[model samples]
Target: MTDAAIAPRRPWAYAIFLVVFGAAGWWAAFQLTLDKFLVLEKGKNAVLNCNISPFVQCGTNLQSWQGSAFGFPNPILGLGGFAAVIAVGVTLLAGARLARWYWWLFNLGVAGALVFTIWLIVQSAFVLGTLCPWCGLVYLVMFPLFWVVTLRNAATGEFGSRLTRIGGILLPYAAPIAIVCLIAVGLIFQLRLDVLHHLAA
Candidate 1:
């Protein structure tokens, strides 16, 4: 009813959202890590010996260098990053007062993760020519988690009021730019589908 009453509740709402999303991300990351390890340990034998179907075959993706993204396994990054996010979420949910500097640092980490996910999506579509379902889940969860957390930080004035003003101004333009980029990337993959199939053959 009153501004003062509503003001106190907003942080709790954001904390709940963050904790739920962070937990989901952690679960997805854990499952993906297990899949990656299974594939690595068993190699080609993993497919037949482990009862993995073609659709769920981690080996299919893991056998390729793209599975690593970097020189090492990608799920390792997910494990560590999501674990940190989980810790932050739990701390906030427990009513811990995070300093402005800490919120800024967390925002930066989430921003970097969102950017990395975009790159992974591009690689999966064009370069890898395949997608892991579990990895897709992580991408879907992380995208909105990043947006919500950043918005929460802005709303709370953790970064400064000016950032919120900037977000309001840019959201309209940013949405369309993101849509167009996604469509363009999808078209590139569609156009290359024939070439990819031929190479596979």
Candidate 2:
């Protein structure tokens, strides 16, 4: 066999990405949680640091019914979920080989998070007509994270042999894909919210 074929499949890069982005997500979520507490302790009239402008802020989102979709603050979910992601990344970095079942579960969780983030993005731009800075930071990390983990799983043949080939081909493009996705979101927000108009005003 060729040397390339004999080499073990180790996704060290993806592990590092997971750790870095996961921590970023955690921090963003933590900030949102703190802001949520501030809203509660001081009431809705309280001023928040994240309230950059009328068009971009967190207080409105925090007070919205959507923020407590599961009968609790959504950032509370991020606090736990991102912590798990960090732990999994640390384990992988330690050279522990995870089972296919575990990979599937992780992929599902990450996929769900991506979907939820997308929904939040849409709601923020359209329904709420405002952007939450801390929540935007969560999206910044989540998009790339979902791509990296899913592509890495496919590259490892966790999905199947066909996807394995495609995954390897696509792995290097994950960052670009994530950038495209973010750009798309930005376009949507700009069209709906007229963000630049607000900025120039």
- Could you tell me every candidate's TM-score relative to the true structure? 0.73, 0.93
Q: State the C-alpha lDDT per candidate.
A: 0.67, 0.90
Q: What would the per-residue lDDT of candidate 1 be over residues 1-201, giving only the tens digit for each residue?
A: 986676433356556766777777777677777767777787666643222333323455666777777898777777788778878877876767888999899989989988887887677666666545566567656766676677667766787888877665554454355456545654654475443344345
- List model 2 lDDT by residue over 1-201, tens digit each: 998797667668777888889999999999999999999999778789999789878899999988988899999999999999999989988878888999999999999999999989988998999988899899899899999889988997999898999999999899999999988988987898787787677
Tell me model 1's lDDT, rounded to 2 decimals: 0.67
Q: lDDT, candidate 2, residue 148?
A: 84
Off by over 4 Å in 1: 1-10, 48-57, 166-201
Worst 10 residues of 1 by lDDT: 48-57
Cα deviation of 1, candidate 2, in Å: 17
Error of 2 at 74 (Å): 0.3
Give the best candidate by TM-score: 2
